[model samples]
Target: MKKKSVGIIAEYNPFHNGHLYQIEESVKATGAEVVIAAMSGNFVQRGVPAIADKWQRAEAAVRSGVDIVIEIPTVFACNSAHNFAEAGVEILENLGADFISFGSESGNIEELKGIARVIEENSEYIENFISKKTKDGWSYPRARRAAVESITGASAASLLDSPNNILAIEYIGKISNALPVTIMRTGPGYNEFETTEKFASATAIRSLINENEDISHFMPEEAKNIFLKSEPVDKDVYFRLICHKVLSADSTDMEKAPAGGEGLANKLKASIRMCSNLEELSESLKSKRYTRTRIDRFICQTLLGIDREKKTDNYIRVLGLSSNGREYIREVKKSETCRLPIITNINKDIKNFKGIGYGISVDILAADIYNIAAGKDLYRFSEYLRRPFCE
Candidate 1:
């Protein structure tokens, strides 16, 4: 009998017990024999640096039962929700995944499906939404939620407010349009701050780690060990790099950065000199039209030199894979549907791939540079981190 496979798009900054539960539930729901995770690299969707590198995170996923881990290029990894969803969906499709699973606050798929339909159709509500936002100076997300509430009379305001629900809706929208994969929903909110009755947020776990608090209660034993053994790069270093780029780079160069638009370049250039840290710069630059996350992503893009218009997923950068994952890759290798080459090493040739984005390349380079600056040779140590499925 053939085994079933499901793909999970994630950034396992530190794979916790909740993540383990989600993986278990996804497998149970989908009856998938294999779980392929398209995970974010050194950065995450919220524009903050990931606590762990891709390889370490991938190892955690594998240890927790993920069959294979593919890299969601940093360009998409650090962008807005919609693009992140699109990129993840595209990668799953390329891998010929049969289903995609994600966590959500509103586990009601029908509600998400309805919202997806509204967004897809570009319904009259969206136009009214834009108009209302233009008048009230609301952020895009806030305006969209307000419009949905007004047009549907369904009290979608609460659903729209939850970050996990927002991403879940985007995932549904992405799958609804072209992908043939089924969807599996999980419990818990992505941004939940406190330990809930059954689930805790990744954000809370990271906060605990940042404050040198005990996270063993939240994370798996293996995950806690990984986090303890590995030291995270200084957040200040990356922030300073971003600030320097913003202050020194020409407007034209900054304009080409990912999420750079609508005079954001000038705003960032002006704000970088005034603010001292990433959080302060974000606060200074955030406007009613652009959210803090969006500005943070733009700063990351500027640091990585990502050109938004030129972004593409041209390679399947494998972070880790289990035995089952290796088998799946072997099966897919024979199919014409898998277009991008699987890349394991960065120093090797990749320039032949056309759709490879500047952001992705720069991100890889930056990670290497980050490793070197911190006095650790990442290239040498990166391979040791990669383990076989069984460890």
Candidate 2:
């Protein structure tokens, strides 16, 4: 009999104790022998730069119990939640994963499933609920929750409001349209900043790290070590890039930027002159239909110069996988179902793979430019630091 495999999509930013708990619980709950993790590279899905390099984070996942680690192509890694979830689901489906394990605020699989069912069915109650809420000028998420509550009662509304729960629903949305992978969720809100005995949000940890404050109370010992060893690029570096793009590019050109649409380019063109930072630029662009996160993703797309229509999963870039991960790859090599090639080295030429080549090149260029802007040699350092799964 073949060994069962589960997939996890993560940023691991530092891979703290909370992450470890999720890994352990995933294995216990799914009873899978192998776990394939699709993680972000130097940048995360949230459009923020990661503190640690990708290889180190992958190594940490392997040490913690993951069997395989694949890179979530940079194009998807630094986009909106919907795109992020779509890219992850695409990789898991191609990998022939049996299940996807994630951490959610609700933690109650039944409640998440209930929400997923409503989304999948697109019931009249949900539709009317969404329409009414949108007419009132509420954001889609807030409105959707209100709609769910109107039909399913307050409990459902409360569950959908949690940040992690929203992500869980998105994950389900992607999975429903893409693959047959089962979902196993564990844990509390990803936005919770306060430290609990077992749960702490990545946002809080990142904020503490950014402020140079004590994070020992929130992270696992291994994660703490990794975080200390890593040096993250300053946020101001990205801010300046955004400003440059806004100042130099014409309104028409800004419209060409990823996710820039519907008079947003002109708005950004005008707003850039008025706003001093990325946060403010995002705020200035936001409206009833466009949320802060959506605006952030657009800015990130402009920074990376990714063409939204061209996004696709063409190859599997290996960040760092353990010996076990390598063995799994070797086993899957014989299966025709696994169509995408595993990229072991960055220098190798893969001309035939259009999407993969574009994704990798874009990421390398972004890292290179970001480093130059910051007066650091991140590209050169990344080449030396990056290692293969078995290495």
Highest TM-score scorer: 1
As a whole number from 0 to 100, the lDDT of residue 150 in candidate 1 is: 71
Worst 10 residues of 1 by lDDT: 176-185
In terms of lDDT, the poorest run of 10 residues in model 2 is 176-185
> Which segments of candidate 1 are over 4 A away from where they belong?
123-128, 131-136, 176-188, 196-199, 347-352, 357-360, 369-375, 378-390
List model 2 lDDT by residue over 1-391, tens digit each: 3467788888887787777777777778777788888888777776666777676777777777777888888787887677778778777767777788777766676778788777668668677877777667676677777777776788776877666677777787777333233333333356656776655677778878888888786677766777777766666777887788767877666666566776777787778878777778888878887777767767777777777666565568776666767777777766767767777766664554555667877767666755655457665555534566453
Model 1 residue 359 distance off true place after TM-score fit, in angstroms = 5.3
Q: What is the lDDT of residue 170 in candidate 2?
A: 74
Residue 42 in model 1: shift from native, Å? 0.4
User: Pairs clashing in candidate 2?
Assistant: 321-389
Q: What stretches of model 2 exceed 4 Å from their correct place? A: 123-138, 146-154, 176-188, 197-199, 256-258, 373-375, 382-385, 389-391
lDDT of each: 0.74, 0.72
